[model samples]
Target: MRTRTNGIQLLRNGERSVDKQYRGQRIFERLGNVSQAEAEDWLKQRQAAVDAQHANQLREGDEQLFAAAAAKYLTECQQRGVRTLETISYHVQILLPYIGGMRLRDVCNDSLEAFKDARVTEDGVKNITVNRSLEVVRTVLNRAARVWRTNGKPWLSTSPLIEMLDEKGQERPPRPISWGEQAGLISRLPAHLQRMVLYTVNTGARDDNVCGLRWDWEVPVPELQRSVFVIPSEHYKGKRPHVQVLNDVAWSVVQECRGMHDDYVFVYRRERVKNVEDEPVMPYDRIDTMNNTGYQAARKAAGLVGVRIHDLRHTFGQRLREAGVPEEDRALLLGHAIEGMPQHYATSTIARLVDLANSVTQTRDRTTLLRVING
Candidate 1:
């Protein structure tokens, strides 16, 4: 029996099948013992799949541009909730001016020479910085060739080799600051920044984690009479949840920050603009980064040149080692990736970590072996 829906019919044996021709293609689907509506739905789905496959085949051809592939890569990254989407987008924007118009197949190492030269000479960026941009380009091209497929045809024939610039001599060693240097740098910074720096040095949390720290991540441990921030896997660099164990000094800083902001732990109070919307000025606003204009001015005034925000984390790790804390404890305190270790920590373990962290607080007893070499 033929249904009103085209290409859907009931067989003599009470079976149903969809026999349809879509876009110059035959789609024959046998849906067993199904109703006319089911046959119709099957036909609709099959035809849609065929249409999409055809569209993909048409789109992912030799005419594909680097910009188009980059857009697709970024969309996939955003959909997957990639933590470094903003950084990737920045690299894409830098690449677009050079390879936006270039065909996917044409974006080889040879073609990238001009962009590399421009970045090194015109932009005055280091080879390592240029390498980061190149790495993004390599990632996009690799995804296009290996992952993205259209009608069994890959987006590109092959991903070309992207040579990274040698960073042997250009590499800068970690500058772990001394306690005296820390005092000078901390005193020069603003109150909000000062708290953040202290928090970072105590916890060894990265700049992003420090800046994005929320009150909600804090889990109170009444047994220990303290709280620790539990960073979700999505928010952390290691793709695993990190427990931000606070020592006595870090806990003290946290106490000072309590009731300051409902959302963020550290925040700055900016002066209200004349015609802008009036917002609450009591709790202040979330700080984007500790490496802002105020931080730069403070560092300069304090004569702490070439000192990056990341050095605070280095200082923490250095101090922990100097305090004679165990290597495994240092790894956990610094949030370093430990294989086969569970994310959730017991109260006892938390207490032990807190003790290890406190050892660094009293820098007076620790050796000052960190030589300050300004770049």
Candidate 2:
């Protein structure tokens, strides 16, 4: 008589044997009086070894697809918590339609020419946008050739020299809104958005910084009788701690929004009412960005068709220059990276910056700029 399991059988001679085909490979082995559970464990180990060997054999440069490499690259980026990972992923998706099926060995500058043409002529995107996508492709190929490897063999033999299109005159100049234009734009926006836009113009902060500003980042200074916000590197564009000194206007905006939200400085008031009989429950939610539909609609209503959210920042910089603020102080106030300057500000330096920032608040300090509208 013989006792049989799924893949193992005990023979009359008190020995066990496994006869099974796994992944098209025959697993045949005999053991001396081993239990069925023990035999199953041996089978599992054999399968894992076979899988590893197959993976190594399939990881050849010519066999691996750019799609696979792109997937791996995205995984690595996500794992590293890359700040611009979302944008990188968007670029990868755009490139995939053209290069996804190509073998890693076949990806090169010549193969990407059609993609560039389609993006420029058909998609009507600027050379800079296309260049950004090409940069992602270059990054993925470089990583495959240098970092990613299997069985001591690189995923790619070498990365090709990917050249970017000439963007010399294709770039759009920054549009700094006039005080009159700012008034028109701000007046057209919703109350909450008006405050956020005003804050950005006053502080020269980017859209992300203004929207992501937190209350906890505010540091009190008894010496100056005011507080300044210090943004962490992770939240800032420069990848360094940035100190934001609020001017009188920005501070007043802060005061208007004080105690509205426990965490965020700028937020949208969302009113909820289930029934007419009940009172409206107003909840303040964090604003993701100042460049939302409200800002766009307001700009449209104000007839500032060429204005962008970033123009608010330029407006502040331009006003500071017109107010006779020095270049170094302007750089510091605008949160531009200055060499040899500490990220943390001294109270005295903060006081001076506050004064300089307050100078732009005067209506008389203005420059007549000829705004060039781009087609």
Candidate 3:
């Protein structure tokens, strides 16, 4: 008598799985949730892989690679235009060696916690860094469970819950850049960077926006006789072209930045493409701007230590409040979602916005280190 068994069967939860003989050994493979038709299609693919292997055209370990799943997840993220995929990919690379060879079902909380602990203890990495790495692992697992399917069953039985480290002990937020400190910092910067800092202080545009700005986005407000720049959705955070209202100081900075570079609004001299200099070398490319290292050196030289570039944005917001600019209008000027824009924002036209923007603009002499605040 021959042994009888239902080799490929559907589980109670509607998942199709296979426990069949392959190469004289019992092979068990689970396919994620898929319809009967899709499951059959997957079976064909599996047989094809085996066929290619027997013909010596396929290498071993093709079906058992975890990194392949992560690569597929990254491809999906790129297809959906996920802006943060670069950060995710960076963290994923850190996790590749830890569990890259484990079978999908073998990844449990115990192994994951071990990986996390090793990252903290052995590598001397911070808990937050470990958490970020674990997050990428969890994301790839979740994508495998809910997105990728083999023969109508999920790669992993389920996605284990991944916890994050508590941020109880973290560095304090960057302090707001004070006027005299700002002035001192700007003075220490090279000529082109000085103008860029002035523009950032006036308009509150982010570093990337200011650095990547192009001349083509300028919209001339002929009725008001001033030009404003519109940063497109892909470049800005809000998924809309940020309307940069140009005030007196900001307009002056813009005028100075113009005619120096044909495309990019801001350009600086590139000495070795990474140093401070005095020339028309900075284009709309990576070579154009002085990076964080140069900025830090300039800050230390100005006696304004412990200042980060992002603090400039805080400085702008603080100055707006000090200048008595309305909160609603300030939101508009800062490229934030205005509270009552649909109701009264259209009436609060570009001219009105320019006035508010100018109110926060520091005077020419204020840029001098006349009254430096201790804090």
Give the C-alpha miss distance for residue 98 in model 2, angstroms. 1.4
Q: lDDT tens string, model 3, 260-349?
A: 777888876544645557565445442234456668789899887766666677667777877888888778788887544431233249
Model 2, span 128-208: residue lDDT tens: 999999999999999988998877888777888999999987877878887788889989999999998899989999988
Q: Candidate 2 — which residues are off by over 4 angstroms?
A: 1-57, 272-283, 363-367, 370-375
* Clashes per candidate (backbone, < 3 Å): 0, 0, 8
Clashing pairs in 3: 31-151, 31-152, 31-153, 31-154, 32-152, 32-153, 32-154, 268-282
As a TM-score, model 3 comes out at 0.67
Task: Give candidate 1 regions above 4 Å deviation.
Answer: 1-59, 272-283, 365-369, 372-375
All candidates: TM-score:
0.79, 0.79, 0.67
lDDT of 1 by residue, 1-375 (tens): 777987787889999887877898988878899877777777888888887667644655546878888999999999999988999999999999999878888899999999999999998999999999999999999998899987889888888999999888787878877787788989998788899999998999999998889999999999999999999999998888999999998999999988878898887786555744665444478887889999999889888887899988988998898888999889999989877666879999999999999999755523234353333
lDDT of 3: 0.71
Model 1 TM-score (2 dp): 0.79
